[model samples]
Target: MDTMRDRFAPVVSRILDEDPRVAVVLAEIGLVPFLEAQRRHPDRVINVGIREQLLVGAGAGLALAGMRPVLHTFASFLVERPFEQVKLDFGHQGLGGVLVSAGASYDVSGGGFTHMAPGDVALLDTLDGWSVQVPGHPDEAEVLLRQAIGAGDERVYVRLSVQANREALPVDGQHLLTVREGRRGVVVAVGPLLDQVLAATEGLDVSVLYATTVRPFDAAGLRRAVGASAADVVLVEPYLAGTSTGAANDALADVPHRVLGLGVGRRELRRYGSVDEHVAAHGLDAASLRERISGFLDVGVPGVPA
Candidate 1:
């Protein structure tokens, strides 16, 4: 199966080769994919040793120097560790570029909590006007990447995770896609969780909206889906447990609505295991998702109708 990471190298290479104005900033991790690009374009493909802060700083510098820089590394190192640089260098300085992050949440399960970054998307939320994309498949990732690159002078964050759907899918636009329609409620499936969401909602009477570009939140589309219903939204993100909860609330704030935020749970699972094991532990498997969705829809949780 071709994971999102597998699709990254070629996209970056294409951008680097085709767009002379583009550059690739890398830390020590995840550099194997872009080795050929580095060999070819030594000036553009820069690996600043093991310095995460420098990675962002160099990218910011590159951006300031009239080059669109694409920073790459594991999610934890790329975002969490060098956040200060990302904030001041990119946000404060008003510089725009692309940040390609790998190993979302517990992707490197055996690498332990130090390597986990479930809160990456949530962190990006703190910034102002960042284009965030969580692609569910390799095809979607490539399309979104091309779009993001095409989106010049805008700060974009392309989240690359291990989890992916069966086939590569395309987005109609930059907004939420209505995969399936229903009247009861709406299930917002963010990125790779589409297949799982589909499997979970097989016989249910709920609308399913897939989101690749989640930063803008696509509130108008969400309202349309809710129609005359209670505006019950279930956000199934591949990142932190309730990363997109605020987005959901903001989207449905105008109407009477309730939300059940689900993803990798908040509680830290200290045990070490495989990625699949970690996923199940967080109640992200198909069975757990189905049960939760059914429960949220069937029962009257804390508020709303029974």
Candidate 2:
């Protein structure tokens, strides 16, 4: 299966060919894949060397000039390194652009902490009027990319990752899709973590909701999922833990609800390891998640007591 980054290149290339207003700005991180697109649309596809700030500034400038800019780079460089430019050039200036980031969380675990961006989503949450999409599969990535490009002057962020599920879920860029139903609680799985979340909650009496677009928080869908009963929500994101717990609380502010936000922890792991190792260390793998989820929900495991 093609990784999300692999699918991104061809989709953006086709968009550049078909849409004249679309422009892609790179910072020499993922340049190889966009080489052909650059050759065809020299002015539209730009490379700003390793200058991460300039990459965002240039993209914001293009947006200011009535062009739709798609900024590409690793998550750390795209959002963390050039965050000031992102805030002022785009948010403060009220410009609209698409910020597409590769290397989600520990996708590039071998590259060490410099390449990991476990707080990318949480950092972006500080800004207003930005739509964030975390696609679990390449096909879903293509859909969300098209929607972001055609958003017409709306600020958008598309997070691409090497991790993916076995199949694509029908994500419409808005609202959550119900994958399983139960009366006890609801488990909200974000992006690539859906498969692991499903396996963790196997046979557990809880509903599972799949989320691709998380910026808006899908408050209404979450409320509907919990229904009129006192709610218990476990948000399984691929980013910083408790990143969206506040949002979840706000969504159910009027009702009685308890939320458990699980994801990449804040502690820095100095040793570089494989992605699976990173997942295990963060307690995001199936086995760890099963224990955590059951403990939080007060639901007994098949062979264990609550």
Candidate 3:
């Protein structure tokens, strides 16, 4: 039976096949798939040794030279180690390419702290031309990948779970996916986590916005989504709380809103597990989301009918 990871591998592989100018700079853990693609299409893959900093720097250099580079690595190593390189070389120059950070947010089991930290989008939130995208599922991931590739100027960060996630109906990076109609409150889910928002709204009426792109956020779409609904707005993300989601939410603060951000608290290197396990441990499950949004609505608009 095909699993979630199975669904994702092919899409990236497809990109590899179609773009002769593209080379995948992948980590040891990320090697197998790209290697397989190369086996099928010899002379396509570029294996940059496991050095995270070198991987990111080389990717930026490749983009500068007009070749598309897909830099793949574990999330922690990708964002944390060579952040300066990404910020200075990629973001500063407004280079285009996909930074595929696998094991995004503890998705890989036993991958260790070196592998897991729910990526904090804040790291790139301030870089001038960098945009962050966390896809909700297979369809979203594919669409976002194409959009990022086409988005030539900005440094696009495509973050996804190492495994396949429940696929939501396809949504454009430009269109916000609505989870509910009559809004009692708006919960803007970050990525594949849209499933949790859907579950949270089972018996209640609330608005849900699925953000495919955190930076270069679909502002017009968001303004319209929130404007149509009379409710408080909250942003949810896998990053450190009060960082990317909060910053993103604050950018829209003029909309008469109250915002709440979600993420794994900051720490050295502690827990190790799959993304699902980490989410459950951090109270990020469907029930938790439902309860939290409900509470936010209650506090924001007293006596609002469910």
Candidate 4:
């Protein structure tokens, strides 16, 4: 199965073909797949070399010129390195564009800390009116990408990752989909981590909520889920830990609730390990998540002691 980044090139290519208003700006991160798209539309598919800031600036400039720009790069460079440009060129200017990113969290763990961007979503949260999409599957990524492109000059961030679920769930770019119904508690799984969350919470009496579009977080959906289940919520995101805890808290501000944020930890792992190894190290794998989730919800696992 192709990863989310694997599906991005073709999706953007089709969008570029169908919509003349769409433009793609890159910083030479994943340029091989887009070589054909760039060949087809030289004016629209732009490669600004390794200059991350310039890539964002060019995208903003295109947006200013009445084109919907789709900027792509490694998440670290796309959001972190060029954040100032993103803040000024787009946010401060009151312009809009789609920032599509690869190398989610620690997908490129061997590439070292410089390539990983677990804090991308958290950093974007500092800005206002930015719609963030973390698609669990390639199909969902395509859906969210198209939705972002079609969203009429709204600032959208399409976060693509190497990690993917076994299957794709229906995502409408807004609202959360309840995967499993239970009364113990609610586990909100964001993007690619849905499968792990599902595996971890197996047999546990807790509602599972799948979230592909995180920003403009489904407050209503969360509230509805909490209304049916216990107010204890566990947010399992693929990015930085606690990234959406605030959003969840705000969603349930009126009610008394408990939220446990789970994701990549703040401390950097010095060793370069495989993705699976990193997942285990960060305590994000199914086994670890099971222990943590069950502990937080005060539930007993079948073979584990209470």
Question: Model 4, range 127-225, lDDT digits (tens) per residue?
Answer: 999999999999999899999999998999999988999999989999999999988899999999999999999889899999998998999999999
**Which 10 consecutive residues of model 4 have the lowest summed lDDT?**
297-306
The 10 consecutive residues of candidate 3 with the worst lDDT sum are 297-306
What is the alpha-carbon lDDT of model 3 when measured against the actual structure?
A: 0.69
Identify the runs in model 4 with alpha carbons over 4 angstroms from their true place. Answer: 228-230, 301-306
Off by over 4 Å in 1: 299-306
Number of the top TM-score candidate: 2
RMSD versus native structure for model 1? 3.2
What would the per-residue lDDT of candidate 3 be over residues 111-188, giving only the tens digit for each residue? Answer: 577666564466667667667777767666777777776665557788877444476567666656776765566677
The estimated TM-scores of all candidates read: 0.95, 0.98, 0.86, 0.97
Instruction: Indicate the TM-score of model 1.
Output: 0.95
What is the lDDT for 201 in model 2?
91
For model 2, give the RMSD to the true fold.
1.0
Candidate 2 collision pairs = none
Task: Put down candidate 2 lDDT per residue, 174-289, tens digits, no spaces.
Answer: 98999999888999999999999999998899999999999888999999999987999999999999989999999999999899999999999998789999999999999899
Clashes of each: 0, 0, 5, 0
Ranking by lDDT, best first? Answer: 2, 4, 1, 3
Per-residue CA lDDT of candidate 1, range 1-306, in tens? 888889888987988889999999888777888899989999999999999999999999999999999998999998899999999999999999899998888889889998999989898889997989989888888888888877887999999888889976668437888999976778999898899888888867888999988887888888888885567889998888788888778877778888989998778889969888987898888888888887887732344322
Model 1 residue pairs with clashes: none
Q: Model 3: residues >4 Å from true position, as ranges? A: 1-9, 39-43, 162-165, 228-231, 244-251, 267-274, 299-306
